[model samples]
Target chain A: MSGRHSKHDLETTPDDKLLRKLEAKWEDSPTRVLRWHKGLDVRGLDCNSAPGWDGDKDDGGALVAAHAEELSELQERLFADGRSGGSRSVLLVLQGLDTSGKGGIVRHVVGLVDPQGVQHRAFGVPTAEEASHGYLWRIRNALPRPGYIGVFDRSHYEQVLVVRVEGLEPEETWRAHYDEINAFEAEVAAAGTTIVKVALIVSKDEQKARLTERLERPDKYWKYNPGDLTTRARFGDYLDAYQELFEKTSTDVAPWHVVPADKKWYSRLAVTELLLGALRSLDLGWPPADFDVEEQQRLLAET
Target chain B: MSGRHSKHDLETTPDDKLLRKLEAKWEDSPTRVLRWHKGLDVRGLDCNSAPGWDGDKDDGGALVAAHAEELSELQERLFADGRSGGSRSVLLVLQGLDTSGKGGIVRHVVGLVDPQGVQHRAFGVPTAEEASHGYLWRIRNALPRPGYIGVFDRSHYEQVLVVRVEGLEPEETWRAHYDEINAFEAEVAAAGTTIVKVALIVSKDEQKARLTERLERPDKYWKYNPGDLTTRARFGDYLDAYQELFEKTSTDVAPWHVVPADKKWYSRLAVTELLLGALRSLDLGWPPADFDVEEQQRLLAET
Candidate 1:
């Protein structure tokens, strides 16, 4: 309430001021509270709800736009920190069913920052080379280097979710992956990479609507997959698989955040807010110059 | 003058309409005319000049902004094309001396598009692993996959430019890189990748001023390098090296655009325009649906 302002006001405010104002308004971090915990029922969650947001699509869009500058600036500082000997980075893991807005988050939210500072990888069905290695091998190779915001469109959890539900691996094989993933994530987290695991949950009804819309538009056909329909047939199994995976893999080092993603705008806003919170938690300062500034200035003047 | 309009008009027009209007205005492609030639003298090029643009900073900035949506859309179409069985991609190779605005172009120009579709790699000094391989090995590995725009901050040209000037490699070794690079680029271009090579040319005076500015700002300190002063001392040598480079390697397949980059805004705008022209030349259209749309739609509706 303290930082309440019209969209126009938010647009015109200077970056630091707007960032501070938005921070004041979002001090409680509603999106952060969405972190997955034991006993949380995935089946009971609302698909279309916007959690702490009460605005329409336009207002939600405006809020995301307002956060753009702050997010961009924070990402730059993070990059600068890494360039100046800081090894800290953030990894955002996106897992969702078909048409659950994983690509949308990448376009609308992760797209807000400098591309130089982001490492985005979309993992589809593993290739021959990838399948030859451990499941985490490709994920390990895709981890963001120091100073980057690494995005995994579909990530390691596919091992537990799809691999489990589809019986691509034996139950014993897939079940052990939960602990292996947790251990891997804990190691990454300890080595200065903050992991943000997000599951974008859309209802079966919403998924039908989305897939129908994709089929209705010629421009969207490339995004459609017949395999998605095959996967959709076992929707209940996927939910159960995700529920068990969340319970086993959401750890002290890196917990999961389940976002209701029927509304594309809200999912984007929520992800952006979650990313903002992760970055702000770094509490970075501009890396100081190791060289003598005045000496460099004098040397340059002579040149 | 076909589509010349005020900045306000550009900001308000719809995306497709604006794209058409701007395409008409840029029909002659001024930035493309800046492409390096066999006899062109790199030393004689005016670093402060804006080439075809006569506007001041505000207009230049507006022009770049106007191009943003169209560029973003074209990039998306490029991505879509690649996603739906197209192999074509764009590689914007940015080679410049210290303080020449390579990073700025990546941030302001290529940054206009989706990060999901961008593969950005900044090649610094070769690591032991990189050094152990053939010079082009890392370059090959970093090439953009289908559906991506790859920006190399400094590219293989460093072998010819810095390696030659700094005596890092013997003259015969560095000299042979020209044909190797040309052959390498030809193969890439033949494989459906359009390579846009850019050399951001900044004068010695401008470099001094920019370095001094970096030294003056605490926030920019990390960007400054003491070694840059050492490089500045060899400015003329670099120009000579670049001149010879253009003569030897400016192929029909991957011609270099030597941009005068003293003004940051002009360089950013020019690079944006050059990239715009490259994407436009692709003559891309949205990929059509691969599946039976009506059948898919019916199935989704039943779901």
Candidate 2:
């Protein structure tokens, strides 16, 4: 947890008040709190550390539960704004290794809002059709519509990360993608979409434990893939690739937030707070009625 | 409320046990509990009544909350089944008049499960491109992938309801759609998708109150459409259209469940019960591990 704030301070600031305070802190930099910046050592970062969050799992779960109503309210406002001729939307990009708690974050955090307002897409190994198109083609197609909160579970960053680590593309081809990704994100941001890119960092030991649990449980077998072990063998390489990804693709329009995800509850809380900051930045208000309320009331009463 | 089952009977059966009892009742006819049969008069049915649910709003709300965990678990099993090479899926089609609490059912009932396992699509007035294609073209594209709970807010029935009432198409063109929709639904069901088609029935007087509430609240203004008034003016004609719709399109494969939607809580509970029945019919258990668990455990240990 950050030293600037204590657990007592968080306990005092609850619900909307806490959200507003965090929004102010976020406005100071947005990246100043939980972001992965240039030259930061990704390997050295503690996966269990809950940066800017001073609480245990039980407290974090309670905090998340408390934020649900407000989160739902804000999402409804966003949906209403879009329906009433507003073009602004939000896009949350989640990037992580297997067992880094990406699915958990989607279930616990994004699940706080109405699913009607959410557009969720999980990118995997490209299909033959997708591989035929330019890398950004499918990504552009999946951008959130106006007034929506879009969540991409394992998104376009796989182009630079997996493609680079696995040598799926030529060196020159994958190397040129960072600048292209940045430009693409800038374009999306300029088109009134707020993009929040997140990297969930989990330690190798934690991932092994999780994988062992998955293997042990029959119900969890569907989630396990043998290929995950291949990826696990190259953990250091993936981290190195992620290090360069942050150095290049993190931008003012869409910065990357590296969430320590060994503690599932903390990661969920951090993502929830980051999403709150993103929605609050929009400063949206309930759209005023477009019709003549008195006339409509009279008409409805007569009917 | 049905006389066959008293409030005491419902109180004794709770959670999965309640779900099982209802599933048995559902298997007896599936429509015996809530079906809108041929001789049933649409206008005469009590909109505020809670059929088969002998409980107050508080009790209904509590029941829905209690079912949440089991609902989530069943959905996960369905998802895992799909991921493990199963072809089964469930489609929940929501059709209703304006302010009939379609959105409320979605927010309160369907919101109980993980959104990732659900695919939600809302069909409205067709765009220029959509109008050019055959009516079912867009609908076919929106069917749930294997292992998903697909929800449609307003569906293909709009072809018969609004199109016929509004005279958007020729008499021959719109009338032919009933058989076409049945054929479409039968084909979808034959492909291993259990279809739960719901018609939320709200009385005209209740609708007037709901629309008036929308008009009164600024936050709800976006939901109010001038065209909704135009539709309400022809409410009788629309009911006649729906009467013919139920008589023609309701089939063994995808029967229509007419939910009394005047009481929002009752409607939510009824829809939740219907969805529970649909998922339970699949009778899915956790997919067994395909790999040697002990070997994988050893491999994970090495990692």
Error of 2 at A60 (Å): 1.3
Model 2 CA deviation exceeding 4 Å by range? A1-31, B1-31
Question: lDDT by residue for model 1 over A1-303, one digit each (tens)?
Answer: 112243325466565565455445443575556888777899888988877665677767777888787688789889999999999999999999998999889988998888889999999889999999999999999999999999999999999988898898888999899889999999999999999889999999999988887776665777788888999999999999889988998887898999999988888988999998899899887899998888888878888
Q: Give all TM-scores, in the order shown.
A: 0.92, 0.92
lDDT of 2 by residue, B97-186 (tens): 999988887887888888889899999888898889999989999999999999999999999999999999999999999989999999
What C-alpha lDDT do the candidate models reach, one value each?
0.85, 0.84
List RMSD in Å for every model shown: 4.4, 5.9
Candidate 2, pairs of clashing residues: none
* Candidate 2 chain B minimal-lDDT segment of 10 residues: B1-10
lDDT of 1 by residue, B1-303 (tens): 112242326466565465455445443566566888666798999898877665578767777887787788788888999989899999999999998998888887888888888999999999999999998999999998887899999999999999999999889999899999999999999999999999999988888888887887777888999999889999999999999999998989999899899989888988888888889899987788877888877776766
For candidate 2 chain A, which ten residues in a row score worst on lDDT? A1-10
